[model samples]
Target: MPVTDCYTCDREAEFDQLPPRERIGHDSLWRVSHATGSELLGWLVLVPRRHVMEVADLTDEEAAALGRWQVRLARVFAQELGTPKTYIIELGEAPGFHLHFHVVPRPVDLDPELRGPKIFGYLGRPEPAESPARDALATRLGAALDRLNE
Candidate 1:
């Protein structure tokens, strides 16, 4: 379906303007990175450059490229974060009517009770202390993406 006036479209310029530390990677049509203030490991988000509400609305090229990017990111997360599995998620209740995917890395040691719902469970909760460990992980993942592009 055709799109108009969606927040993602309106804010396309702002995506590039996001600081370097927040950026994980970007192809022609999508931008990917870790979500700000996430409490878990390797919590990534992939957002389309254009505004679209649903995955089915993606153009054929976008559909193909999106899968490729997501898979590549999953590999990077696993390799860099020591995650055993990666969960690709799409929860669309937000101001940005743009299609996006979440690449959540699942570490083997995660508490079973906190594994699923609690991964992103603290989304709106008060921010946690600055974790040097998470910062290091992000640096490694960002460096990994840079190497992949080489």
Candidate 2:
């Protein structure tokens, strides 16, 4: 995907302009932000600042930092949200999405029916009464990630 046409790239432009609920954490290579249309709280996304359709296209610095970002973000989610595990998925198939990783918190006892890829059903779905508010979740996670990065 071309940088100009990438949705992630457009969001990156909002680094300073977007509200906290939209922009989360980021470094030199990757920008971590809240996922749109997701009903799940702490649904963080890690996207490269530049457009790159494949993980193989990541530069050495970007690839190396990507690992650290994943580990750190996963750890923060586990620490702050008390998630037993985190699911990290990278699929660049969607139009304008480019290559991005979805870092999702998985409760220890996630329903069997919703395990694995099925968990994605929660994304873009209507809000559940049990779902936490996204703005509050983003604030907590963003602060936790900032402290972790320190």
Candidate 3:
């Protein structure tokens, strides 16, 4: 996607204006946010601050910090939300979607039927904006991220 039409870039523009649920945390290279239009909590997304569509396009500094952010989010999810593990994926396939990684919290009791890639079902079918549960989780996750990063 062109920079002008990129969804992730638009969201970055709305940085301070975004709702609490939309802005979780960020470092210099990557921004963490709750996935929009999803019914899940702790369904965090990690996107580069700059507009680059593929992993190969990442600068050396961006590549270096990428894995650390992934692991930190996973650890925060486990500590705060009882997530047993996290599912990290980067398809970079959707048009205008920008390059981002999904760091999904797989709870200990997740149904056997939704294991592995099947868990992607939790995405897309999202609750409305200002969803109380998702927003609340965002608050908790935000705080947890602070502690974890500290």
Candidate 4:
């Protein structure tokens, strides 16, 4: 079931209509999409197909699938972006926001100040990542994920 007001639920409801950048890939339990309003390329968000307000709300199956998706997305980052590390974060503090995990790529040459949790500073920047670039990476990353399943 989905919460009527949740962003994740709204997107999930339109999964079939979502663009490549919005619907990178998904399975029975989870969905993956490139983060919007962020300047950082390859910033991905992992969300449950259903509305989940808290991590504890996840069923055992959902939890397992979440771990698998996290690892797979990180692997995709390593292979596609040459990310030295990836930060996985979940903060369901905003109203109408469903639980989601942020899989942010840590660039090899990232500024020391932006390392670790500070990397979040890249989000909601003055200028968002260009759509063409995001879409291109989405296509490539989506293909990489497909290959990994082979």
Q: Pick by lDDT: which candidate is best? A: 4
Give me the candidate number with maximum TM-score.
Answer: 4
Q: By descending lDDT, how would the candidates be arranged?
A: 4, 3, 2, 1
Runs off by more than 4 Å, candidate 2: 128-132
lDDT per residue (tens digit) for residues 3-74 in model 4 = 676677888888888988888988999988998778788888998888888899899999999999999998
Provide the RMSD of all predictions against the true structure, rounded to 1 decimal.
3.4, 2.6, 2.1, 1.3
Worst 10 residues of 3 by lDDT: 126-135
Tell me which residue pairs clash in candidate 2: none
Residue pairs with clashing backbones, model 3: 37-126, 38-126
User: In terms of lDDT, which candidate is stronger, 1 or 2?
Assistant: 2
lDDT per model vs. reference? 0.72, 0.79, 0.83, 0.87
List model 2 lDDT by residue over 1-150, tens digit each: 435766777777767886666667777788887787677767778888887788888999999999999999889878887888899997678764578899989877778888789889888796552324666677787888889857
What is candidate 1's lDDT per residue for 86-129, written digit by digit as tens? 88889888764577788888888888876775777745555463
Candidate 1 stretches with Cα past 4 Å from truth are 1-11, 94-96, 129-139
Q: How does each model score on TM-score?
A: 0.78, 0.87, 0.90, 0.94
- The residue-by-residue lDDT of candidate 3 on 37-137, one tens digit each, is 66666777899988988899999999989988988888888788888889998987876567899889998988898889988877778465456776787
Q: How far off is model 4, as Cα RMSD? A: 1.3
